[model samples]
Target: MTENGVPILQLSGVSKSFGAVQALTKVDFEACAGEVMALVGDNGAGKSTLIKGIAGIYRFDEGEVLFDGQPVHIHSPRDAAQLGIEIVYQDLALADNLDVVANMFLGREVLQRPFRLDEAAMEESALKTLDSLSVTTVRSVRQAVAELSGGQRQAIAVAKAVMWNSRLVILDEPTAALGVAQTRQVLDLVRRLADKGLAVVIISHNLHDIFEVADRITVLRLGQRVNLYKTAETNQQEVVHAITAGKLEHVPGMASL
Candidate 1:
């Protein structure tokens, strides 16, 4: 990745809590450029909490976040976006009534002059981005998002994220609720994102999809990071064990495991 696998995004001893409930505890996580780092865990294992913290949805109660090896404070979603971090949640967030181009530039539309939209520039850029990602399933970029299949919608959401020079993209359950062929399409797009030297963190419960796309797997259990494994060096059984029974000493009712 980025010279000896130095992480573009790194978190050290990160912790977050809500009143009496600890969602994340001293969790160390990193994602390097040119690789897909899959964040996996059983339900309520802090996967969402950890990414939300990184995405600036929730501030970490403790620990430091470093980007490009320099400490930075992320206090809001806008801050995260400025830092080139984009997270596509499972909802995909595309407006069904809008066309692909309109959806891609929903908030940050290019302007031609005083109070005019740069329709040509926006369309050209959108087409270029979709083409660059090898997203060819769409019949036309001008077509309504509601007409596209699940996979095409996911692709548009991802394309919208990366169009703004995003350095790191976090996808939450991208392939979930898709058909077999659609799943394949999204997985291939995930790999292409990493191949373009962008650090990609994918959160998914499907170990099969994780193994197919991720270069490294980070497993969380009971709000604690239990293990990190290189995909080629480990198997699904080991990852499953880590998710279900990995040891955690600090979390309540989990120390015995």
Candidate 2:
């Protein structure tokens, strides 16, 4: 927590339900600029519900979403995007038929005139954004998305978020399918996102991947948040205990995820 008294993005007393099923229970969590908050839990941990609420894929039945210290209601994905919230799913959703440039600027295409597509400007900006993240050796902006490796796909997804000027980028299982080298590549990209001052929320199951890149860890048990811990102040065992037992008997300042 910062002495500044507010996180870049905050959810306070947030709750959600599907009829009688309470998917989330009075959850409070926050993400700050220049940091990665890992949301981890076992099966049926309410991680998905919480993420859906945050991403505006599902509206919360209760509580508040504070972006930059102001209360706001995100009614839809469009609303989230307008607020600079970008969610990068594990699938990436890139257009395989298009190249990196085309995929990055999909839907929000630039036009040279009233109706003509601005191919030149789009390619230039895509290259610029990828380059800013130190993503060189892309071969060409025209290379098809289907032709890229797993790591390159992840990089493109992240680069797309960065291109949107997203203040908070939520990543779901970014390194799940990658080999060790590819995993390292995605992790490095995540670090770069934080270093560029974007608040990142990562949903992942791999402990080593979580520990390698996350500055803070948020754990969910059942459908409730059990604990949130600073990575520097806790060990993997403590985190594991919190995930399974829903409590840490010895750790100071350990709140349930």
Candidate 3:
């Protein structure tokens, strides 16, 4: 937690190395409920590796991860999900053969007794969740995922995560494949997620979306955190500088030019 009473999700001095390649080094970052924190860095800057660590795919060799003041070992993706950590990848991960409801409850089927799928109960719950989210454009949860627009598909992904009672939803380049309108829709969904008190960690290269939805920005450069600041405290230029030059700010301590 911060000095204030607000709770926080934190990673302290986290490091990961593959063979001789050091992908991440002593990374410290935090995310709070009701806030969207954007993670920005160039390709191969270790952003993916760090996030994968948090996602429970790669166990870090150093540092600790805490959720709401408790250190937790997320050894697998299932562990992450059970802890309310959900990831919405850039690919969206919707099976084209499956309908909306089936996709939403893919591995986690609502079942009775001997693992029999409870179709009626699942459908009712899925519809209720969608309706509450104002997703009216969907004809039916029975429609194939391949038949939905990019925005609709993205909506299904977010709804599924939210329905799973996720406290932290990590979106990886959510709007990358979306057009202007679709991007707008997805950004709106992200805002709604945070507004509903979910800690959102967005990994995106698009500054516009970052500025639109993020309350805090953490810039990573060359496998290290350069700076973390509130959105109102910095601009695109400074973020670019920190990300490229590996400097958080243009300090005045430099020798006379």
Best-fitting candidate, measured by lDDT?
Answer: 1
What TM-score fits each model? 0.96, 0.93, 0.92
lDDT of 1: 0.93
* lDDT digits (tens) for residues 1-20 of candidate 3: 12232445799988787876
TM-score of 1: 0.96
lDDT of 1 by residue, 26-110 (tens): 8899999999999999999999999999999999998999999999999999999999999999998999999999999999999
Per-residue lDDT over 105-199 for candidate 2, one digit per residue giving the tens place of the 0 to 100 score: 99999999999999999999998999999987578889999999999999998999879889999999999999999899899999999888899
Poorly placed runs, candidate 2 (over 4 Å):
1-6, 248-257
Best by TM-score: 1
Location of the lowest summed lDDT over 10 successive residues in candidate 3: 248-257
Clashing residue pairs found in predicted model 3: none
Using TM-score as the measure, name the better of candidate 2 and candidate 3: 2
Model 1 misplaced regions, further than 4 Å: 1-3, 253-257
User: For each candidate, what is the lDDT?
Assistant: 0.93, 0.86, 0.85
